[model samples]
Target: MTVVQVSAGWVPLAAALLLTVATAAAALDGVLAARAGGRPLGEGLLTPAAETARLFRQRRRTTVAADLPLQRIGGAGLLTAALLMVTVVPFGRWTVADLSVGVVWFNAMDVLLWAALWLAGWGPNSVHPLVAGHRFLAQALSYELPLMFALTTPAVAAGSLRLGDLVAAQSGLWFVVWMPVAFVVFCAGVLAFSAWGPFSAALGGGATGGVLAESAGVDRWLVTAGRYALLTAGAAFGATAFLGGGHGPLLPAWLWVLVKTALLLAVLVALRRRLPVVRPERLTVPAWLVVLPLVLVQLLVVSVVVVVRG
Candidate 1:
């Protein structure tokens, strides 16, 4: 399948699409929370818009010795990371960059997210936020290797790093069907990087809102939006890498891509605040003891199957 790359000038379309999906995720999360509390669904739907307006009207709050420039960069860089992640991701038959090394590109973006998040924490120069930043790095160290192996599984099976080829390789069977472990790990990686759900220790699970401890006003909004954007990007990429990107009956390919991405994004959002927060300290233990070994075994299984088929 030939994926047409849109001109660089139309990159805003990608950004628009990401924002749209991110907004939907936010709305879904709000609605779920409302339902959980037995509140009206209409009020839940208005949550995102209301929060945005409230934050917009609020004044900026500054720390005693905050690194203002770095703080601002970190806040903005987070949303930027999500934008870059989607550049290589195709919406059905069209993509922005179409890089042959799309898989590695996502890997690099995840690393960039580490830097952005750390900066967000460090720039505040506050104790809890600083601690939160370090906690995320600690949490990242545990999941990253297994995450890498999970990512490698599909590329190994498809025998190419190109996402289009990976998608095409799933014509007969979605990778998620045969590579369930990888798909699970991949979703875990998404939540971890987004600082969401059970993986949100860095966002103030056991501590004082960790990275969010010192944020205020517009700055706070940016960081919050960034997390949603990252989750949205992950869903889009995961749909491509695992769920057989855009391959479905009846609906147009692009619509199928949107539908799959939304479904995955919805699952991730509904799970927020519902699961126990994995303490940053204890997170490393199970991540290493159980998750890592399972993904490694999954990788080995994939390698054997690929070799046998060859």
Candidate 2:
């Protein structure tokens, strides 16, 4: 519960740790895909490495009037956003940046993904990618408010913007235990921001490969790897904010953080394979008309509880 702020020099190590977890999540996804295709699990396990090599070896695909600079920046943005999100996340007892408004910092980083994704689509200068970019923005508009409320409810409950305080507050009970709606909404926001599985209309909704239509070589690799990285980052934050970071019966706090993050990451990776697709069009109505109000009520409930307990 008492987290120490780690030094800047430790940032590289933390990045490595996050990337390792992201890779494992990618491998799990490959394994799931292999299971569905009746392939050997070993091949699935090798999918990440193989894909990385393949993309690196492949030549870049160029398009007419392509804004190569913008395209490349967009491709790199998801990973950037993920890395930024993790800076505030306390790993066991140490964190890189313990901002007073860590939760707000997280929300700001997630919002950056909207621009990252849009720039990715716009960079290619193709009709399909353009459509993909637009759809993602539309979809983002619907879920972002709900996502904001979901993130805020925990902050509201704990009465502090600091993530360390949020974790300490959960010493008795996790926010997820009493704030189911916020937890569920937060998870949905993670999926949406990552463009994972069901929320992947921006990738394949408008046209073949959507924003990825013309990407090749390292360009393709960054965007794809980043998608998984975003998922990893989101899972880690979810574990921290909702499930009680590093809080478990027997494991060390740091180990418990990893365990909870990995479990949640695996479940999310698997959810992509099992759920039915919800196109951007279908997502808007439900995200606004249904999810928004439920999370609001959840927020109200937490507010009331915090007042009484105080």
Candidate 3:
């Protein structure tokens, strides 16, 4: 088992900053994934940097009668929600908060995305962004319950909500191997929450960028960065909840955390290129009828196993 140490004052701050870097790296990797297919890899690697500089140089636009406070909050809330979710995510043996109810903590932060995206989409007072915000709410209904059930499987197996305890429980076997459906569903939820890949209905191309349609300059930059940051946090959480966290031999535990998170992040990013954007309307039925039942069964199986073993 990994040794647990009380984090120093700077630990949480450092973890937050580390998550920012990870988010950036994930964004860069995503750019690479999009451009690397049948093309030079160098171009893909540099795309994020180029885009960042361009966004940085762009001027802020003034929206007539826009709710500035809500707009700013919505833009920044993406990163805020992402950072909050990582508080209980252990790096090596360290976590920021390490709450007894870490699973619930993660769920709470994820739940905040509904407000963040909605406020953002509504703040602009544009038809497209308003539509985007509504779409996200509809999308949330489809994924949130299944996501909760998926997360429950691990907590049930560990018999605790503490993330560290969950990691410890996985020392014998990774949860992903045992609960593949839950893992898949959880990953899908990650994409849904982050508005990534197939689940990116909030910023769909159909509406000419949807939530991002009216956003420009720094406003657009923050929204885009926040989405990627959320994706990074989800990947890290998945690594901790399913991949035995930092458990590994030879290298330091921290490195293992980074490796696993990066792998998941890359897969999420690559998925954007592989799959078409899934419409919220199309997903509603399947999410309720198909994925939800599958995840519930996974939860049931886990509960029964835990009872038998108990």
Candidate 4:
């Protein structure tokens, strides 16, 4: 048991370190790609980084009427929340921290989105930021319920809320196989929740960018970094929840986890470029009233399978 426990503990740490390294490499590769296209090395980082540089090179203009403290707090809070959410994610056989109510913890962390966006918007005290915040709020309401239902489906099927157990239960067949509808719903929710393509209404050019328009300097950088980290964590969770976590033929468990996560992130990146944003109002009705019900039904189906199998 001691040996097993030690292995289990080290595995997750190793996986996380590996993931960090891979993210760094991916950033480097982006830089190289940009340079090949005659862009500066600064342009190679994630879109947010490139955007931040652009913001930095431009003159910093502050609205005389803005709440400085709130703006600072908004930027700091976004980074903090994104980092905290990562702690609960399972990288391989273990997570940075595990709780009995891991699924609940994940869901609870998501609630922080409202405060983060609100602060970001309210601090700017500008028309654009205000509009962005309201747009984000509307988008958040649309996607979160379906996301919650999709998240619960796997927990119900595995009969555990712990992310580690959820991954373990997929040793044979992935949840995506049994709960295809839930998988689609979860992926869609992830894209929307992260405000990625097809759900990036909050950040589209006309609508305040939505709240980021008012941000500049380090404040903007932090928010952008947080967004990438959040997306990474979301991809990791999706891999562990629906795809088999670090389980595959031939490769070491850690490598398997890395492979799966990379694949998922690549898919997300591809979708980011390919898909177009949908308006918040149009998405809400379908995502909540339609997708949410389908996910609930998927949960019921998963539960029935678990019971019957047992």
What value does the lDDT take at residue 247 in candidate 3? 87
TM-scores vs. true structure, each candidate:
0.98, 0.98, 0.94, 0.84
Model 2, 16-92: lDDT tens per residue? 99889999999999999999999999899999999999999999998999998998898899999999999999998
Error of 1 at 177 (Å): 0.6
Best by lDDT, which number?
A: 2
Q: Stretches of candidate 2 above 4 Å error?
A: 205-207
- Sliding window of 10 residues with minimal summed lDDT for model 4: 1-10
Question: Candidate 1: misplaced stretches above 4 Å?
Answer: none
The local distance difference test score of each candidate is: 0.90, 0.92, 0.84, 0.71
Give per-residue CA lDDT, model 3, range 1-310, as digits (tens).
5535465785667556655665566556645665656667666666666777888898877577877788779878888888888778888877777789999999999999899888888888888888899999999999999999999899999999999998999988999999999999999999999998898889764647878777878888888888788888888999999998988888888788888988888787778777888999999999999999999999999899999998
Over the stretch 1-310, how does candidate 4's per-residue lDDT look in tens digits? 0001234555556445644743553475476557667898776778444665676786645786998788778766655665666566565554666777878887787678777777778887888778877888898888888888888899998888987788778888988899999888777776665666777776553445677787776777666666555566677778878888777888777667777777787677557655567888898788767788888888888888888989
Best by TM-score: 2
Which portions of model 3 show Cα errors greater than 4 Å?
2-8, 11-39
**Residue 203 lDDT, candidate 1, scale 0-100:** 85
lDDT of 3: 0.84
As for model 2, its CA RMSD to the true structure in angstroms is 1.0
Give residue 38's lDDT in candidate 2 (0 to 100).
97
Instruction: Report how far residue 71 has shifted in candidate 4, in Å.
Output: 2.3
Off by over 4 Å in 4: 1-61, 205-208
